[model samples]
Target chain A: MKSWLTTTDHKRIALLYLGTMTLFFTLGGLVATVIRVELATAASDLVTADTYNRLFTLHGVIMVFFFLIPSIPTFLGNYLLPLMLGAPDLAFPRLNLASWYVFVAGGLLTLTAMVAGGLDTGWTFYTPYSTTFSDSHVILAVLGVFLAGLSSVFTGINFIVTTHRLRAPGLAWLRLPLFVWSLYATSLILVLATPVLAMTLLLVAIERGLHVGIFDPEAGGSPLLFQHFFWFYSHPAVYIMILPGMGVISELVPCFSRNRPFGYGFVAASSLAIAVFGFLVWGHHMFVAGQSYFASVVFSFLSFAVAVPSGVKVFSWLGTMHRGSIWLTTPMIYALGFIALFTIGGGTGLALAMLAVDVHLHDTYFVVAHFHTIMVGGMLMAYLGGLHFWWPKISGRLYSERWGRIAAYTLFIGFLLTFLPQFVLGTQGLPRRTASYPPEFQFLQGLSSAGATILAVGYVLPGVYLLASLVRGRPAGDNPWGATGLEWCTSSPPPPHNFVRPPVVTDDPYDYPRAPQPTITGVGDA
Target chain B: MPEAVREPFADPAHQRDAVALGMWAFLGQEVLFFGVLFVFYTSLRVRHPELFAAFAPRLDWRLATVMTVALLISSFTMALAVRFAFTRARRSLVLALSTTMILGAAFLALKGWEYAHHFEHGETPQIDLAGLGRGPGLATFFGVYFVLTGFHALHVLGGLGALGWLAVAAWRTPASDLRGSPVMAVGLYWHFVDIVWLFLFPALYLAGRLAP
Candidate 1:
């Protein structure tokens, strides 16, 4: 326990983040359940309207800030970045450890805010409402986000330096794994975009605390300016959440397909493209929020432009799996689910990007469905896939393949059931962030709530078996799944310093079919 | 003696380069940090020019000049400290770092006095928001000024803590085995704070002067 607390080992830090994020995700998920339960009926059956507002706010705050943003980057990236690069550890292990502690500090503070008369400002923390008006714990919540943003910047800088400077002698840029490329792209956004959020949140805190609000309209402050700054970091933050998941999907696709990615370079380049283009489209969120027509047009166009790279990735993954030895393993199922769900998610996003369409869908259940399709459907699915894919390597144990399959299918179905109707409900005109709805929407609302329960079950199933695997499951030997990254060359759960001997990358990443080692499926080995 | 080399690097030189590169990246992050405030200031100034013109001269520029010079000298001393780190001049490194720390502290002291002066003129911490709607919008200008400089002050305070640690570390370490990366990184940050003030100096102290 002491070693766990004091250790600078990247692997240990990864576990620390994993444990913390899981707790937050579960908390966030629980909040989500109550939200869905309340939404099931037209009347506020489960909670008061005020309580309902607070519940969704807590869900969004916990999920977005605490879990999704840090989900892959801190948890999976921390553990695997060094191992993939053939380095002993991240560029700054101590800073990496510091990032986790800072994140937890932020999480705990936000929880305190939640407990102390939680804000109904939504996670966006839109100003005037957030800074000058709403009397909820905006100061604490904004400070919590500020600290998390700082941790993100540090984590991003660590990855950027480590990937650039610490790659083994032969691990040239082109030889880099897709996951590394995805993380590198993700870090660019992390380092650059996060501070903008920090500044916005800082201003929010100052205003909220001192009654000297920057976004106060009575003070000549444009609330639109606040939205501009908030989304500048946040929209890129959306990509930050998903790009790493794309990276994981990149790894899982080729590994399961038994084929090299058909458009590896394009897919790699798309991550960078998405990061760059993401910064330009923050205005789309403001089109109907009193923004000018000309600016909204430009923002809407840019939003569509950003989707091109995302589409490039989707097609590239499909092409990679076109004729290869396709395995319906648990991870692959989630990857497949990701592609299907994210396609709908991304497609709906484009719909929302249209100037006219967004006027109809803005702040409706459709918007909720659209992003959940991307975030929950795309990012969360990819996270689960990566977790299952790397579980053996992370824990040095093999989970039940049968059970893993069960959870993936259940999750995919539950996700679709929960979100699909919301898109229709949105078009039919049900606004989001409320408990009471018109009686007409109740049928779909009930269906959505039922789906959330199944989704909860889907999420929890893995926890039970994954924990069990740590003690009783078969030991995962080096290179389970017969993968080709440098990480697979090291021991399962890795050593204290990661590798017993530093690995030099002599083969290409995902160099399957050519990875001469016999495949050990980790399946049926027990 | 502090170790000359750290882990995950082949040698001290590689370690030095990585640390330098990391600091540059962080500086890029900081630029965006200050960049947002500059943006806010520019838009607000453009919207309410006379209010800014009226408010800009309210700050005692002479005091700001003193603060600016103090920060500039600290940055210069910080550079020397970094240079001395590479040269393994422990005594010189300590001298330069201490000088930098003192200058940074002095700048903060002058800033405090300036804030006090502004307070005497009713530029208290809370913005007099009534000015935004019906009056000179002087509060808005002052609000931007306070936030911009306030964040910079926080950065300098954080820098002082770092610089003080570097001074102690330099005093304890054998010159021959001194690692320059940490010193160089801190130096870069100190210089960055100075550069921000260079921008802040003009933006706050000069930019809003009305034509004639």
Candidate 2:
């Protein structure tokens, strides 16, 4: 325990992040389950309206800041980035460890705020209501989030420097695995955008704490400016959440299909493109928030522009799989799920990007469903898939492949059952963030609530098996997947120094075989 | 003899590159950190152009100029410290660093005096009822002013801590152990804080200077 606390090893830090993030995920997911149960009837029966507001706010904050934002990058990226690049650890190992502590401290502080009677201004925390009204623990929550943002900035700086300076001797930029490429791009967003969010939150905390008027319009501050500043960091924040997940699929698709990712350069470029285009489109979120029509038009157009790079990535993934040998591995299953859900989510985002459609759908369950599909369906699946894919490398034990498939399928189906109805209810004009809704929406809400059961089971199954595997499962060999990345060449649960010596890259990433021999491990191995 | 290399880096040069790159990445975010305030300030200017103009002369630009000069000189000394560290001149490095820190402290000292000046004249973010009734714009102008300078001061304090740490390291460690990269990293941060002040002075003090 003491070693875990003091170790600056990136691998251990990755596990540290994994443990805390998983705890937060369960916390957030539990709140979500309660939310769905409350929605099973249109009566606000499970939680009070005020309590419901706080609950949803807590749910969004925990999941976004604690779980999803740090999910793949902190753990998966932390564990793999060094190994992938053939470096012993991240460029700044101590900084990486420091970020985890900061993240957990931030999480704890936010939890304290919840215990201190919870914030009700929603996760976005728009002005006037957040600053002037809504008597909750806004200052504590905002400061907690600010600390988390600082942690991300540190992680971003570490990743950017590591990627730029720590690659194995011959691993040129173009030769990088798409996962590394995506991470590099994700770090760019994290470095540039997360600070803006911190500053925005500081402005929020200042107004609330000092009774100042940076965002309070009654005191000559424009409330709309708060929206502008908030979304400036936030829209890119969603990318920070998803791009790393996309990085996961980019690896999974090629490895499972036994082919290099089709249009590797485009796949790599698309990540950077997403980062660049992400900043230009924050205005789209402000379309209905009293921003000027001219600004909205430009924002709406650029918002649609973001979809192009997204489509490039999707088509490239499908193309990589089109004629290649395919495996029905658990990670592959989750990757396919990610592609489907993210596409649907991105498609809806395009529809919402349209000024007229957005005017109708803004603040409705449609927006909620859209982000959930992208985040939960897309990012969450990729995270789980990557975890399973790297499970052996991390723990030196093979998770039960049978259970893995079962959990993946269950989670995918459960996610669909939960959110698909919301799309319909959303278009039917059911507003979001309310405890009670029209009785006509009860059936869909019930269906949604029922799906939470499967999601819980699916979520929990791996937790049990993955932990049990650590103690009792089959010992995984060095290259269980026959994957060709530098990480695969290293031992399972690699040494303190990742490699005996940093391996030099001699070929492109994702160099694969058409009719490859089955990997050393197989189904039911555990 | 060169400084010992850290793990994950093969050589001192490689580690130096990483430190440099890391510092730049950090400063990149630091820019956005202050960039938000500038963006908000610009948004305010757009919304209340005349209000900013009317309040511009209210600030003591002469005091701001003195603070600016101190910061600019400190940045110069910081650059010299970086050069001295690279040359293994510990004494010169410490002297240059001490000079930078003193200049930084002087700037903050003057800034505190300026804050007291504003407080005495009732030009503070703490808008009482009368200030609010007179004009919220007045309170908000002070609000933006204090936040802008306050955050900058916090960063200056942070830089001072870094510089002090490096100064002690330079003073105690052998010339070989006192690596250039840490000194360079802190130098980068100090210059960044200086550059931010360069922008902040113009935006806060000068943008409204020529107004009636």
Candidate 3:
């Protein structure tokens, strides 16, 4: 166990990330519960305004930075990239370990800030308020975020290098798995965008700590500049959070559908397209914040343009399931759920991209509903799906398929009930970041709070069953899903060096027809 | 003698390629890291041309020019170190790396001196300087200046540390034990740091002078 502490293996580092991220996820979820309970009524009867502010801020910071951003890339990407590529480990194994430590260090610093006083400036940390007004641990929180950004940058470097230099022979660019391509696109965004976020946060810290006027209005600096800097990194950051999840769905859809992806080139290219266009649409976030109309128009167009790639991916996944022997496995159910919910989320996003509509919806619960649908419904679903899909290979054990399917469906339903009301409430004119709302919005808020309870149950059920499986589950074979990646070619819970014999990729990925003895087993038959 | 490949790489050449590619990717990230500040600086300058004109004369351009020359020399020596490592010239490798480190240290010293001069003149980031009034423009200028140069200096310090490590390795290790890839990687980083300074010198010092 102590050796595990100092291990530089990418697998161990990935486990480290998984453990810590789970802790943060629970913490963030608990905070969300508090916010929901408070909003269960029409008034701020549960917690004080200050505490409410802190609760939501902590929830956003923890969920966005500690959990979601690193969820797929750091944990799943770290665990599977080398295995999928048929390599011993990442190119920089030591750096991989270092990134985990850095992530933990950042999480600890932010936790310390929370325990000490807690930030109330929200996760976005808009200037003037974050710089001059917020009487919270702003600098400490910014520093924490800065450290986490550093970890992200290091992980990005590792992924990009490993993908470029470590692919098995004959795994040509065209032959690579969509998941690998998505990870590569994600790495591109993480590498390019995180540094700007770091510098932006550093500027915020400097202004707050040193009384220097970088973004403070009283100091003659434009607060709008801060928004530009923040959203410039943050908009691409949305892709950083979702692209890897998209990758997981790409892998899961093919394996469960028992067919090749409909248009692999289009899907893979779209990930890169999203990454590039994700950077240009940050200004849409600033439309009502006093940005020029021309800039907003350009950004609105770009935001809609970025959604095209996402649409391509969705169509490709649907195309994959067409006329195929689809296995309704737990992972497949989650992937299917992701497609439905992500479409709603993305459709709302397109609506929000309109300069006219966004004026009314900018800070409303509509925007909140849209993002939660995409992030929680889209990203978290894919994360759970990928986790279940790879659990056999990861732990050398089989979980109860019945319980897996139950949790997936429950989560999808619970997520819808939770966020769909918020969209209605937003159209009814209830703004976000408020502890209290008009009594008319209470019914929808109640529905949202009730749905959150179900969502919590949905989230916790998997934890219980997954942990139970670790102890009493049956042993699993290497290719339990009949997956056609290099990872499946190795043993379940692969060896330290990943492969016994170095794999040479002779065929394109997801070549289901060419697989020896294609056994499309039921989810129950392990 | 052909060197044995490290774990995770199939051969020595593959390992070398991976390391070099990783460093270049990292350098690309650094470009964006510093690039944001340049954007901030440009936006602020455009917003406050008069304030920049007033404060432009306060910066010590002569000292900055000297530091730029030192960094360029350091980069030259770093390239030489990579060349020597490739040829298995251990003594020359040690010499070139040491020279790079010395020049890097000189650049830092000059930067440190410039910072001290600013502090003495009350041109610090924390307070409104003597010549600059209480408006945010001049203070913003100095703040940007400090952060830009401060981060650049940290990179130089990191480059120096990398150079020192390479120097020691070249000095103590056998030719068989020395890896040319690590040397070249460090050299790439050193040159990147130098190039960033090239941008910073003009952006911080010369941009203000051109402010109308």
| TM-score of predicted chain B versus true chain B for each candidate | 0.93, 0.93, 0.92
Tens digit of lDDT per residue, candidate 3, span B1-212?
Answer: 22457678987889999999999999898899888888877887788776677787888889889998888888888888888898888888889988888888988898888889888888877644344345665566787788788888998888888778778767778975777898888888888888888888887677657544
Show model 1 residue runs off by greater than 4 Å: A516-526, B128-136
Off by over 4 Å in 3: A516-526, B1-4, B128-134, B208-212
lDDT of 2 by residue, A74-191 (tens): 9999999989998899998889989998998899899999999999999999888998788999989998999999999999999999988888989999999899999999999999
Give lDDT for model 3. Answer: 0.88
Per residue, candidate 3 scores C-alpha lDDT tens digits across A392-507 of: 88999888888998999889889988999999988877889999988989899999999999999999999999999899988878887777899988888999999999999888
Candidate 1: tens digits of C-alpha lDDT, residues A254-365: 8888788978888889989999999899999988888889999999999989888998988888998988878778889999999999899899999999999889898999
Look at candidate 2 and give me any clashing residue pairs: none
Better of 2 and 3 by DockQ: 2
> How many Å off is the CA of B85 in candidate 1?
1.2
Task: Give the candidate number with the greatest lDDT.
Answer: 2
* Model 1 chain A poorest ten-residue lDDT run: A517-526
